[model samples]
Target: MDRQFEAGPRVAAVICAAGAGSRAGRAEPKQFREIGGEAMLTSAVRLFLDHPRVGHLNVVIGAGQRARYDAAVAGFSDPRLGAPSIGGATRQASVRAGLAALDAEAPDIVLVHDAARPFASTGLIDRAIEAALRDGGAVPAAPVTDTICVAAADGSRGETFDRAALRALQTPQAFRYADLVAAHARAEAEGRDDFTDDGALYAWAGGRVALFEGEARNIKLTTQDQFDDDLLRRAGRAFLAQGDVRTGSGFDVHAFGPGDHVMLGGVRVPHAFGLMGHSDADVALHALTDAVLGALGDGDIGAHFPPSDAAWKGADSAQFLADACRRVREAGGAVAHLDLTVIGESPKVGPHREAIRARIAEIAGVAIGRVGVKATTTESLGFAGRREGLAALASATIRLPFRDEDGL
Candidate 1:
């Protein structure tokens, strides 16, 4: 419930995602597509949900999209987000449906946005709200930079005009709650549902519309080329730039015990003996769990799941690593990479290296490429050389929102 803005009028947002976006060149709608390691819808919802001014929000979805929507926002909880509003065939209708859903709460201001455009920044939202409060309506727009042209029926240029007065309008358009409701009502009554955006509808209904600055990077993903590896990398960097990077290291040792298999990185490798620990003696995962916690400065694994607690007796260590990853997410961060080195002599790690890496990646909810597993021997100088125990060293790299020096 912590926010960064001063309190004002109650703000709500309608995220329009009901359209069957065939142009995005995907089987599913573009809003359900993956962007920056998450669904486009999730990114958009998180943007408005995290804003201080927004008190209520609703997502308008097409029929039969409930399952996809649930999976995209799985584990996310916020009182501001209500049930999904059933949308009509058109974007205008979909937005109206969302607006109608919010009629019960009747927020002071409403910002209508496209779920496809997930990169809109908080500053842009601030400008839109400010303009809406000053004027009656606001639209985020960018100046047209390309040469003006007119296309004819035969695909020929008809006219060339000056581009100075041209502007490319974007979404997250802001308007007074009552004014927008009245505008939509008028449009529906007149059987006019052709308005592509709310700003135009409001304007046609005699509402004053003002323009505000828009970010160049606030793009609506609409093509397959936009999902290219290189483009996504740049987009990920832009998204992650708001956070600071951190790295932490951890080490753990577990002696041998009587068992048929040993758990390493959540994988059971057949061995003559297993590692000894309070839980499933997963040395690799325990070290990784500690490394992740260390990066967040949230203490080690023992602090969160104490050994004295009988509840964790014989528990799966994968849950420990999963919990650590959850904490990072709750703190508004993401795991960038994880590296683990197993030091042992008995259970040869080479044969199960790929499995260990895959298991760790699955447990951490990251790509397999982001998880690295390596094995080394102690050269007959330590307990690992004598095959008395197994040891692991791990490092975790994470990205977190920038905190003031004193804030930590």
Candidate 2:
């Protein structure tokens, strides 16, 4: 069979192996269990460490499993995979700690993966990484093949959910290192500790997240029945040389009317008149915010932050955009790149382009290089040309960190 490959940016893999795996009924943690000829965690770690693009590796092991994990990795002399560290109480905590354990020379991107999913394939990892590089953050997720029933707390079925809208999220969730670090710090400080995954914590912190199709073969070894060496090995070999990528587009506009100031990329840009709207009339920010939200299949800005509420009567536009970006990032996605074009002859985009990009970078918690800003004139043609007010258009490319067998 012909082999296929996809290129992606530098990434760090942070394996969460701190869980006890009590559900698996194993003498040792499932991550330490042998899948084929190697420990599960070791197998998973080897995947990313072997990848050429993977620049750093951090393994978060349970406090007591350090010695055993160390022994398991002793044979793999990859300097990129740093020495393991003790994980925290919860999975989120473990991820945060694992990210912290990365060497001072951390990679530009980070992929947080579940060590128990020993069957995760390199193709899935490549797809996730490609998604992240294009969209900002990425995660491996399989469609909910089984019928989904939404049950009430009283043990009664409330309603059946749309299978098309359902997905069984899986790991190797990836993100930009700096954004992930900041998000974790923010969530920790805010005392929001109820997340079941890193992506959830990221969303709560207002980061954009993107999703990639995951292979059903890459099953999490959560149950004894699901543990099969043959299946894992088969899946691994089949996807050893495959990869994928996806792209999305977003655009938003608001007419100029009245307000104190116009918000652009989460920064207040001085203007003669504020754009008219419920929230702060930041045409640029709104456009950017919608672009991100739209890409994630999340509702538009109005649906998220409604104008119906009086609280947002004159709220800051930057906050709205920041919050939206937070949702995206928390979903294991990153703002790969964003290009915004402000329309209108007044308030020249030339002088403010760099400032707008900087502000956007700050809002999305991404490097300035990943954000772009430019301006164009209507050539005195339409509404913008008439100078009735100013308008803006934005396109965003986001990336999701993906977990690959080769830690690239």
Whose lDDT is greatest here?
1
Candidate 1, residues 1-408, lDDT tens digits: the string is: 111233568789999989888887778888998876789999888877656567888999999999999987785788888999989989899999999999998777889999999878766777788788778688999988899889988999989878899888998999988889999999999999999999999999988789999878788888788777788888677656646889999899999989999999998999999788999989999999999999989999999999999989999999999999999989888898999999988799998887687678768876565789999999877888999999999999999877687375
TM-score of each candidate structure, all chains considered together: 0.58, 0.53
Q: Candidate 2 overall Cα lDDT vs. reference?
A: 0.74
**Residue 108 error for model 1, in Å?**
1.0
**Lowest lDDT 10-residue stretch of candidate 2:** 238-247
lDDT of 2 by residue, 1-408 (tens): 011224545677888899998888766788888866688887788777645456788888888887888877877887787878788888888988988887476566788889888767555665666666765666777888888898899999888989998888889887777778888899889897668887787777777788888878677888865655677677555444223222345566667766556666666677776677777677888888888777666888888888889989978777877887787668666566777888887767676676577667656655465677888888999988887777878777665544474365
Considering every candidate listed, which one attains the maximal TM-score?
Answer: 1
Which portions of model 1 show Cα errors greater than 4 Å? 1-7, 233-408
